[model samples]
Target: MSWSDRQSPIVAVATAPGRGAVGIVRVSGRGVAPLAQALTGRTLLPRVATYGPFLDADGQAIDHGLALYFPGPHSYTGEDVLELQGHGGPVVLQLLVARCLTAAAAPDAATGRPVLPGLRLAQPGEFTERAFLNDKIDLAQAEAIADLIDASTEAAARSATRSLGGAFSHEVNALRDGLIHLRMLVEATLDFPEEEIDFLEKANARGKLDGLQAALQGVMRQARQGALLREGLQVVLAGQPNAGKSSLLNALAGAELAIVTPIAGTTRDKVSETIQIEGVPLKVIDTAGLRADHETSDEVERIGMARSWEAIGQADAVLFLHDLSRMAEPAYAAADAEIAQRLGEALAGASTVIHVFNKADAVATEAVATHLAAPPAPAGQAVALSARTGEGLDSLRQRLLDMAGWQHQTEGLFMARQRHVQALGEAAEHLALAQAHAAQQDGALDLLAEELRLSHDALGRITGAFSADDLLGEIFSRFCIGK
Candidate 1:
C-alpha cells in the first residue's frame, strides 16, 4: 500500500528454475542504467542486446550471455529495466542475482547515490503489478498475464491472450463510458430543477438506459462463456455397481482410463479425466457406485461409497447413471429410486444433476421405451445413451456444455474469473435499478444518479479504475513467483 512497496526496484529469475536453454535475471526500477553498467562492465544501450560476461562485485566474469537494458517511461513497468541473460544453470543465475543486489547496496564512485539499493527479490507477480501501477497495463490486463500463463486449455490460453490485449477491458470501458455520459446528462439536469423533466425527456434517458442494458446483457453472456473456460465444470459419474459408470467414463474420455469388468464393484475407487468438450474443460469423475444398506458388505466397498458421496457433494454436475437393461427388476428400480432420493437430498439443488439411463444398446426395445416413457429422476433432466456403443454421446456432451452455460463461439470470448463475472452482474443490477428510478411516476433524478454512479463503480472495478488495496493484493498474490 505504500509508495516504496510498489515502486521499489525489484529483481527476479524470469525463467523457470531448472536447467533450461537459458535463464534471465530481471531487474526493474530507477537507476537501472548504472546497475547494468556495474553488472556488465559496459553501459547497455537502451533496447539493445549486448554480448558480455556478467560481472561479479570484484569485476570477475560470472557467466557469458547477453545484457539488455530498457530505459524508463517506454518499457515494461514504466521503469528503467535490465536483464542478465545467462546460462540456465541455477548457481550462475543466483550468483548474478547476488551481484545485482550487492551493486544496488554499494554507492557509486562518481555519484553519491547508491547504484540501486533496495532492489530486493520480487514477490509473486510483482512485475505485472508494477506494470499496472505505472499505467503500462490495466489491472485486468495484469490478471490476464497470469491467466495466460496458467491456462489449462488452448481455448483458455487464447481467451487470456485476448484479455491481455485489452479486448475485454475495451468492451467494459465502452459500457462504462456510455454510463458516464448518461450520468453526466442526468446529474447536469439536476441543477435546473424546474426543467429537469424536460431535459430528461429530450435526452431520451430511458432509451439510453435501455441501450446500456442491451450492451450489458451481451457482455455478461460473453463473460459467462469465458467464466466457463476459466472455472470449467466438474461432473461426477455415479450409479450402482456395474451400471456402466466406467464404460461411460471411458467413452467420454475416449480412452481406457477406467477398468471395466463384468463383476460388480470392479471400480472401487474414483477415476478422473479432464476432457475438452467443444473447447470447454469438463472434468469427469467416475465415482464408485452407491449401494443399499444390505448390498454393500465389504469394508473397502463401504469406503468407496463414502468417497463417492463426498465427490458428489463437491461436483458442479452429477450424472446419475442407471442401467436400462435392469429396469425390469423391481429390486433394481427400488435401489435406484433410493439412490435418487439420496442424490436429491445430498445435492441440495446446487449441482446440475442429470439422470442418465446407460446401456441402451444392450437393453430390450420394449424396456427402453417404457423406461424412457417414465424416467425415475425427481429433480433433473433425463438422458439416455449407450456407453459401450457410444450412442447419443454427442447429445450428452451438448447437455453438459449447456449445464455449464457454455455457448459455442469461434471468437469474441475473453477469459474471465468468477470475480469478473460477479462484478458485471452487479453492474447490470445497478443499471436496471437506474432504469427503474428514471421510469418512476414522479421521477427520482438523485436516486437515478446514485444508481448510475454505483454502476460505473462496479464496471470500474473490472479494469481496476476503482479497487481496494486488499483486492490488488489478493489478485496478484495468486500469480506464480516472478510473473
Candidate 2:
C-alpha cells in the first residue's frame, strides 16, 4: 500500500462530540508524524497508543491523554493518520483541536514549507470519500456506512451491515461483469459476420442472453424487496362516509390521532400516523370519508376526496374498510347487489387493496366469516378484526409487513432513496429491452448494443463512476457537520 498522492491531512473528532470519559481528535494526511510530534512534544510510534500531554502554545499542558500514530496506506483513508485522545470536556477538546490545526499548518522540517497540503477540518463524509478515491472501498460500501449510522430499525441495521460487508456491491459488480461478457460476445459476432455465422441462431448466444435476463430479473426482484425493507411501507386508508376510517387509523396507530364521532363527515381533512408492523414501518394515512353529498362546502369535500385518491394512487398498499355491519343494515342490504355491480370495475384497478372487514366484533356471524374467508384478500390482501378492541390486529400487522416484503432476516440491504431505485429500475428496463432485441434472428443489433451501453451507464451511476459534482455535493451535504 502507498500513500494517496491526492490526500490532505484531515482532522475531526472521530468519536461523538460531547462530554464523556474520552474524546478523540483524528488527523490524517502526509505529515501525521510531524503533527503528532509537535502536539505531543515527543516521538510517536506507529500503531502504538502512547500516553502523553497535548501542549498549548507556551508548552502548557492542555490535556494529558493518549496519542496513536498510523503510517500511511495501511490506515483508514489510506493516509498517514494520528489520533489524540484526551479528556472529553468540550473546552479541552476544542483547544486540543485548535492546537493540532495550528501545528499541522506549519511547514515540514525537511521542506521548510507546507508539506502537508493544508490540514483542514474534514468535510462530512470526506474520510469516506478519500477511502473511495483511494480504492479502499467502493461508493456503495461507503454509502452503507451512513445507512448503518442512520438505521431506524433492527432490520435496517442488519441490512446495512451486510451492505457494508459488500453484499450489495458484490451483486451489482457480478451483474455488470456478466453484462460486459455478453456484450463482448455480441460485438465479436457483429464484427466477424463474413464467416457465415448465425450468432442469433447459436444456442450459446441464446442461452447466455436468457441466463443474463433471468439473473437480472432475479437481482431486480431482490433489489425491489431490499429497497422496500430499507424504506418501509406507506399505507393509506380510504373509503366512503362513516366507514370507520378514523377508528381504523386509531387502532393502527394505537392512539387517537383523528377525531372520531357519530358524525358522518366529522373528519373533513387528512391525518397521518406512523406505526410498526412486525418491526416494519407503516405510514398510515386516514382521510376524510368519501361521500356523494356533504353539509360542508363542496370545495372542502372535493379537496379531501382528491387528497384521498392521491394517497391511494401513491400507496404501496391500501386498506379499504367496507363497514360490513353498516352495509348489512336493512336499507343497505337490499341494494348490495346493485352497489357491488357498480363498484366491481373501480376496485379492479387498485394496485394492492386489503379488503379489511372493519368492526368485525359487531358482525361476528357465520355469513360474515364465510364471506371474509372466501376471497383471502385477493392474493396479497387481508381481512381482520376490530379497530376498536385491537382484535386480529396482529394478523393485520403481519399482513402489512408481508406486503412490504420485510423478512425476519433482513440481511444484505442498504438504505436507498427513491432516486436510486428509479435508476436501477431504468437500467433493468434497458437490459430487458436489449435481451428482447438480441433474441431476434435478423434484427437491429446496433440498437441492442446501444441499450446495453445505456444500461451499463445507469449501473455506473450507483458507484459514482458516472455521477456529476452537484450530485456528490448534494449527497454529502445531507450528512452532519462532523461526520
Candidate 3:
C-alpha cells in the first residue's frame, strides 16, 4: 500500500524523555511534508535540514529548531518523514508536538484527503514496524534494530550490528535452502518410481542428514554463546564446609564481595556478585557449605544449604572448591577423606565443574606440586590457586571465557535472546523429526513436509517474518516509548 493510503501520519518523540540538550519529534507517513510546511511556513526539500520556527495555528512560533524531511519509500519507515529538533524541555517539546499535530491534520488538495485525519502518536516500535511492512528491512533485521538499541556490551552491540547487516538472516536462509533441497529430493523419490536415483538408497542420505544436523548444532552453539554474552551466565560455588568457596568467590570477582573465615560454616547464606571475565558476564554465587549433619538446630543453615542446592541445579557451571592446605592441617585432616568422598558425589552429575584447590600458598612442597599436577578435583582436572593471593586466576578466567564460547576475534557473533534460543531449539527439533520421517520406509511425505514447514516458520519468527501480532507488541512494549 502507498504510504498515503494506509492510515495517516504518526508522530513521536524519537529522543529520550526529560531534560537534555536536544529532543527530536519525528513524524512519518503521507502528512509529513504538509505538516512541516504548515508548521515551518515553507516547503521542505527531501533529505535537507532547514532552520525553521515551529509555529502554531496563529503563526506564533512554538519552538525555533532545525527541521528535516525524508520523502516516502526512501526514509525510515519508507514513508514521508519529518523531524523537528527542538530544545529538550518536556513542556516545550509537548507544545512542539501539539503544533505539528494541529498542522498535520489540515486538508490537502492533490489526494483530496485530509493531510493527517487518522494520524496519532505512534506506539512504541510502530515506525520500525511500518518500515518492515514497506520492505525497508526484513523481520530479522528489524529485530536487530531493537537489539542494537538494547545491547549492553560492546560485543553485543557489534553482533547486533552484524545481524542488522544480514549475517543472521543469511545463515537461516541458507539452512532453509538446504531443507528445500532435501524436501525436493524426498518428493522426487516418492513420485518417480522409475527414477534413476533412489534418494533413500543413496549412501549419501545418512551423510546429508549428519551434515544438516552438524550445521544446525554449530549454529545453535554459536547462537547460545551469543545469548550468554547478551544475558550472562549464572555460576554457583558449592562444596563442603571450609572449602574456600567464599575465597574463590572473592577471587573471581577481584573484590571482597564475601566474608571468609577459617571456621566451619561461617557463611550461612548466599552471596552473589556480578563479574566479567574477558567481557563475558557472570552471575557468581557463593553459597552455604554443604554438610549432612542434622543435630544442630540452625534453621538458617538448613535453608542456606537448600538454596545452595537449588542454585547448583540451576547453574550453567559450578565451582566445587577444596582446600588443599586444609587437608594437611591437623584440624581438618581427620575429616578430609569423608569430605572428599562427599565432594565427589555432590558434583558427579553437574553439567560442568571446576575443581578448585584453594590456599595454594601454604601447602607442603611435594603435596602442592602433586595437587597442582592433578586435576581440579577427583577428576584430576583441577587448578591449584591461592584465591587470597590471586595466583592462577588468569587460567581460571580463561577457562570461564572458554566455557562461554567466546573468542577474542568474534567476527560473526550476534546477540540473541533466550526466546530466540528456544525458538531455534524448537526448529531444530522439528527438523530432526522430519529427517527421521524421511528415513522411514513408505515414509509419510506429508508429515515430513509439515515438520519442515514448521521449522522454516520458526526461523521466520526470529526475524519477525512469521511473528504473531502479540509477539510484536511484547517486544516493542519493552522498549522506551521514544525509541
Kindly report which residue stretches of model 3 are placed more than 4 angstroms away from their true locations once superposed: 1-9, 98-115, 184-214, 238-251, 254-273, 286-313, 328-351, 369-376, 405-409, 433-448
TM-score of each: 0.95, 0.78, 0.78
Ranking by lDDT: 1, 3, 2
Question: Candidate 3 on 1-483: residue-level lDDT in tens?
Answer: 344434567788888878999989988877466677778889988888899788888888888999999998889888888889989999988888877676666667567666667677877887887877788887767778888887766777888898888887777777777777776776676677586565656736546666777787877777887777678788888777888889888888778888888887899888999887655678899999876655246888888878887778788788777778666565454454454555556557665777777778877668977765654355435667788888888877777667666665556787677887887898899989888887788657677777877887787788777877778768766666545
RMSD (Cα, Å) for all candidates, in order, is 1.9, 5.1, 4.8
Model 2, span 1-483: residue lDDT tens: 124423556788777767899888888777578777778888898899999799886788999999999897887778788888888888888888888777766667787875355677877777776777767877777777877787667767777787778787777777788778767767776788787666667637557766766876766666666566567787888776677889989987878899999877787888998776554667889987765333347787878877776777778787877677776575443343333333344446555677787777787677567657654345446575788888878888877766666665444455555555676888888887887887776756787778878888877777776777677667766665445
For lDDT, candidate 1 versus 3, the one ahead is: 1
Worst 10 residues of 2 by lDDT: 334-343
Better of 2 and 3 by lDDT: 3
Best by lDDT: 1
Q: Cα deviation in Å at residue 6, candidate 3?
A: 9.5
Q: How many clashes does each candidate structure show, in the order listed?
A: 0, 2, 7
- Candidate 2 ranges beyond 4 A from true positions: 1-7, 17-21, 107-111, 191-203, 237-274, 285-293, 296-315, 320-355, 366-382, 405-420
